[model samples]
Target: MSRITALTPDQVPAESKSTLDAFTKNIGFTPNMMTAFAKSPIAFNAWATLLGSMSKALDVKTRDSIGLAVSEVNGCNYCLTVHSFTAEHMAKLPADEIILARKGHATEPKRDAAVQFAKKVIETRGNVGDADLKAVRDAGYTDANIMEIVALVAMYSLTNFFNNVFDHEKDFPAVTPAGAI
Candidate 1:
């Protein structure tokens, strides 16, 4: 059970109505997280903007990989389930790759670098050493990619922390943690 109650569209603040509608129209239903976020319009709007902006940053596979890595590191089952579903259905990443990403690994070498870098950002709280920086650069990621990777990590970390704190009920199909069945 969720620690907080999820708001329906009619129950949410007026400012959050449009954003909630968009989510409903796009995904065919409002995510429980969005409903929970609706308790504060400022948080809802800010999160919507952050997610929209970051959607353009990296390829689907890379973005999903970062989400999976961050979610796993944060131990956010809610985010892990949502991202695992998106990674497979929307991003077309194979099941094996999705599992690897959740484990903070990647099959593709370049993507592996991004995943590892994201994991480091979470584990070290953005205090990565020189070698960590060089590894992604050596894998052919430009400065812009590096910045976006950091941004992605920050964004996912916010959601992970939110869901973990709230213990939000999972709306999507459940996903086990990386090592579990």
Candidate 2:
């Protein structure tokens, strides 16, 4: 059971209702995380705005890669499962690649750099060393891309922390972490 009540669209505060409805229209259902976030209108709106803007910053695969890597490192199963579904379906990443991303890797060199950077950001709490910054830039990412990568790390970290605290029931297909029985 979730520590926080996951609000339905009608049950959410008036300010959050439109956001939930938009989610329903776009995705065919409001994600559990969004519904849980609806419990606080300020949080829900902030998340929606940040996520909407960030979606344009990176390619879908890279975004999902960052989400997967961060969620795995944070041990947030709710985010892991949701991002796994998006990575495979929406982002069109292969299943094997999705698994690799969850482990903070990618077969593609540039993507691997992004995933590794995201993992390191979480592990070091954003106090990355100079070499870490160089690795990502050396992989062909521009300064803007690096900033986006950091923003994605921050974005996914927020959701991961929220899910970890609430233990919200996952509405998506379950994805066991690599090495889990």
Off by more than 4 A, model 1: 178-181
What TM-score quantifies how close candidate 1 is to the native fold? 0.94
Task: Kindly list the per-residue Cα lDDT of model 1 for residues 110-174, writing each as its tens digit.
Answer: 99999999999998999999999999999999999999999999999899999989988789888
Candidate 2: which stretches are off by over 4 Å? 178-181
Model 1 RMSD vs true structure: 1.4
Model 2, residue 161: distance off in Å is 0.6
Tens-digit per-residue lDDT, 1-181, candidate 2: 8898766546889998888889878777778888888888899899999999999987889899989998988889998888898888789999899888988999989999999998999989989999999999999999999999999999998998999999888788988853461
Clashing pairs in 2: none
- For model 2 the TM-score comes to 0.94
**Full-model lDDT, candidate 2:** 0.88
Tell me how far the alpha carbon of residue 96 in candidate 2 is from the true structure, in angstroms, after superposition.
0.6
Clashes in each model (backbone N, CA, C under 3 Å)? 0, 0
